[model samples]
Target: MLSHLEFSGFYFIKNLHFGELGFVQSAQGFIFLSGLLVGLIFMKRHERAGAAQVRRRLWGRALELYGWHIGILLAILALSRLMPDSWFVWNRWLGRLYDGGDVYVAAAAALLYQPSYMDILPQYMAYLLVSPLLIQLIATGRAAWVMAGSAACWLAVQLGAHMPLVALLDGLWMGGATLQPRAAFNPLAWQVIFVSGLVAGALAARGELQPRRLLDPQRPMLFHLAVGGLVFFLAWRMAITTGLIAPEVLERFQAYENRVEFGLVFLLNFVALGYAVAWLLVAGQRSASYGLRVGATLLNRLLSHPFLVLIGGYSLQVFAWHVVAVYLLRLVDWHVGPLAEPLNSLLAVAAIASLALPARWLASRAPTRLADAPQPSRS
Candidate 1:
């Protein structure tokens, strides 16, 4: 969540360039953790209510996200018109929505084709849509089958043997206007990561998963290797972003987008960097230094504190509010010239941070305690 907030705040700072310098890996962590939590929650419920109930509830969540996507888009459109410089239509993604008369139809289909700044939720909706099948596979002790299928789908995408569902939507309906036919993050390839996270989370929750590799204090080699991979990626990224090396020079080893396949380099970067983060988070949890221990103590307290737990507990509201916060901050960044630069930066931070305020309020309103306690149950 901090990474997300920072990303939104610095969307103003970065100002339309997504280079190697940006926080690229945070999206994976966000999605992976999301699926992890979903797995933890859904698997427990599945065990109780069975796969059918799990599917229904999962679909309900997807429907909620679908509504959220449309709502956020409409909200942006409504607010954009009120601005004196309502230029998103001409200057940005609003043009995609403005392209046709049957935009009503296109809007209905936003789930398949993604809009800019609003892709992750829809992709998550897609993931959750299939989660029941995933759960069934896991329940049958056939999770390897799902993993194999996910890998095959990813490989099919890599080999150009797959189709973008959005383009198919366009060709079949919507009069063949091919506007933005694929999500920026391809769900085909990324579902593997989601399923992987889900498996890890579910197993851990069930007390069947262990971080035996780097979590083991006896073996420091795996930790060093993970850290080394991260350092290498950072140095390589620096070389490219700083123009010390040409990007194309490493094209065989590393590539970006390339018409939207997550190339080998991208996957390697995610795994390597994710491992580094998990290494620190899990392995370093029990370090010997007094200051480190104190810091961890405070960090755990802050994380469990009502403030963060509130926002974390209600992922949907916080996510929707983030979309609203981001574009509003973008408008302010563009228009508020008197308070440019640093103030813009500060305001962006405040705006993104403000998402927590309402969430905390909502969470606080929940009946965490009885209206009036019964005098300690009187033994």
Candidate 2:
């Protein structure tokens, strides 16, 4: 559903004219879940290998990501040169991305070169680069101090005190404008989330998180309903009382504020929403019906095997296709039939499905050396 929604260009719920908060909620849930999973994976690895080993591995991955990013830039440059008169126009879109100044902002979103998923790879690399420092800070058992320190750094950036080192590595783009409270993708702002992930990872590694045993099946439906109502009311009332109830604010809260340098309030929302989603998934796994099971299986499969489930596990190919399509559309400046939107959507989906097949096939076939392992003889 999310894959379809994304390709269909329904990023924001409001874009679909839906007053319901489901879309934003789902997106936030996904992002927060991603962070949690990242933390869990790394923390577990860290525990097994010790911080030194984990840090070394992560550093290698970070370097690989940097190389990959440069490769992406090269590919974009090559494609542009090769197809000089092709259907797409990269220059205009890139210009818009530089300043958020574009007339067709909606159409050429990916093409415009904003800090989206592709760009987010580098953002994640930034966090990985600083992983050891963040891990050490959190390990000191002074999470509060770390948060405060992160906040201070963010404030410095907001004050336009640029960190040249990070800029040299991650490039000049910071999160959405407004530096105060240091929200957004700027390393200064994002340290909070990265640290938070580290803390969460540490907690998870210690097996400190309580399992979802409280939501037993014996619990009455009314009890669950009442609790849900209470949460909703509290969220709504708090928003109203604070007078920061804008769509962006609501969206952030719904998603878990890990937005691309989104605001502080939004960031808080990100945390809240993360907990909410975690709770929901826990409860749902235990209490939901067969339909939910089927739906979840599909969703999990797609997320787990994105390349196989959607197209090919690589979203880059899909993205590159979109860029080419946009270029074509712009070349003729043609907005002619219904076919444009529908066909584009179908093609994207098809790309995802087709790519998934090859990816799955490749994954299934392991190299003989990797598959070979010495067996221990039984006494």
For each candidate in the order shown, give its overall lDDT on alpha carbons: 0.67, 0.49
Expressed as tens digits, the lDDT of each residue in 5-52 for candidate 1 is 332233355443333442345567778887888778888888888999
Task: Please provide TM-scores, in order, for all candidate models, with all chains considered together.
Answer: 0.82, 0.60
Residue-level lDDT tens digits of model 2 in 1-379: 2232223232232234211332233333433444555567766766677788768877888787666655554455455557645213445434333334442233223222432233444556666777766565555566567668867876665555665554442332333342221112455565566666566666566576444543343443533464465466456645655776997767655453333444454454455545443444455445456654464455555456534444434444444444334444443333332244556455445543444543445556645546676667898
User: Which stretches of model 1 miss by more than 4 angstroms?
Assistant: 1-23, 104-110, 164-167, 176-182, 205-207, 212-214, 250-260, 287-307, 338-340, 367-379
Task: Please identify model 2 stretches exceeding 4 Å from their true place.
Answer: 1-34, 86-88, 96-117, 151-184, 211-260, 287-341, 354-358, 364-379
Shift in Å, residue 375, candidate 1: 18
What does the lDDT read for residue 164 in candidate 2?
A: 57
